[model samples]
Target: MKRVMGCHLEIEVIDPTEVELQVAVSGAWDDGQVVESLRCTLDGRAVDVREVRDPAGARIHVLDAGPGRLVVDYDAEVTGRARPATGTAHERSLYLRPSRYAEADKFFGFAATEFADVVEEHGDDAAVLLPYVAAWVGSRLDYVPGASGPTDSAKDTLLAGAGVCRDYSHLTVALLRALGVPARLAAVYAPGCDPMDFHAVAEALVGDTWHVADATCLAPRSSLVRIATGRDAADTAFCDNHGGGIQLHVSQVHAIVDGPLPGDDLAELVAIT
Candidate 1:
């Protein structure tokens, strides 16, 4: 299925600041067919943007801008489904480690107590564990918009029992990591999302292939288009500023499939396109 995804961001730059944006669809899917574009402007004038590609294919748009109204626009028309591929040794090792939001190390006890039996039965089977983790997380947390903050961790979500999509992804990723499955988070454009914003979902490695696990279940996993990916939200945030200050004033995201959105089968392994 072909999907159209885009976002508009309005920001206030308090001073001369360096900005990094991960809002574009990843270049990992550069198969000569996907169409995408990104533009940045400050006070109606185009800003000089540098595109830096990460090892995993994330494109970071960087710029140095003085105080002004900064706006970013991105659009992508992604065609075809993602191809299944094996995880590299480095990827397997890296994602298994705990990160800022997905605190895998801190959840060993909780994982053992909550999912030990599933592990024993499925034995690192991502197909089974992925759905199980999604359901488990969906049951554990309430989808409260302001229930979590930027600094909240999976441990925090587990305690509060309420959060948004990122929080759900963090806890789901952490649980899978603690259960001996290499897992990470993917920030995506979800076509059917109720709140209509950037979404996060957990991805786990199973038998070499990586599969998505959306605890929020806010949209069909089959229709999600990947924007950025990492061990947690810290690595995949839409925007970041350093050595200066900026405030996001407005953000609007949109995604739509060319045809009807396909139904998702959580028990099946589906990679984010």
Candidate 2:
């Protein structure tokens, strides 16, 4: 078994004149299987937190007035439960449900022809289809920062041919859905990741478990720390609050596996807020 950990934030109002603010954050993960427990602190004081589980669970939080600094701490132990693929017709049907397919109009412009060819060639196997599509996106799209957003259509990314991680994941999801695979987007903060920048990836149900694949990462065997997942990005956004001015300043992140622990470090696994 392998363990992965990280934290992410969505700062809506960064430069708020008033220190007191109400913040809503979704996608906190701390279920026994993936995460053990999650604790949140605001303005140096701990506040009551809540949890709700649905297809789209409430990893969300409503924060009351506080001080200048907001700190969050999280820990999780990932038990590597290898979701071995079950070659069954029912699994194939579940993956190919009509709801999984994206609207015909939303196909990526640059890879539309090639994506279509992939579907024509391997639509029958969900397991085979996912890796092929993920690798295709990874190799085809160049990672350019400040390129696009969650709602940016696949056509836009393909035309520009350069995008951030989210754009790449979005394009991959769009293509997977177009090919009738039930794919979703995930938000996570990787260890050594810039505090201000959250990570996004793609997930698809294969057999009885959800298999994760990130076109941006491009390694099938690498372990990923998952925060939240949904049909798309709209469902798994990080910091979401209204009526406050926000500002974000981030430094470059460095990944170190074995080093002296820093007391100020955010968290070992992904934090929802």
Q: Number of backbone collisions per candidate, in order?
A: 0, 12
TM-score of predicted structure 1: 0.96
The model with the greatest lDDT is: 1
TM-score of each: 0.96, 0.65
- Which lDDT tens digits does candidate 1 get at residues 1-273? 789999999999999999999999877675865888888999999999998998777888999999999999999888887655458899999988998888888998888888879888878777788889989999989999998899999999999999999999999999999988899998889999999999999999887878888998899988988778898999999999997799999999999999887898777788776
Lowest lDDT 10-residue stretch of candidate 2: 264-273
Which tens-of-lDDT digit does each residue in 1-273 have in candidate 2? 345454423222344432221112223333444544444554556656554443443355445433344554444555444232222455445433322222323553433476667667766355766777877888888887777654575667777888877777777777776666666676654444433255777666665455666677632223334555655555565544445554433222222222332232111211122
In candidate 1, clashing pairs total 0
Q: Assess the local accuracy of residue 244 in candidate 1 as a C-alpha lDDT between 0 and 100.
A: 79
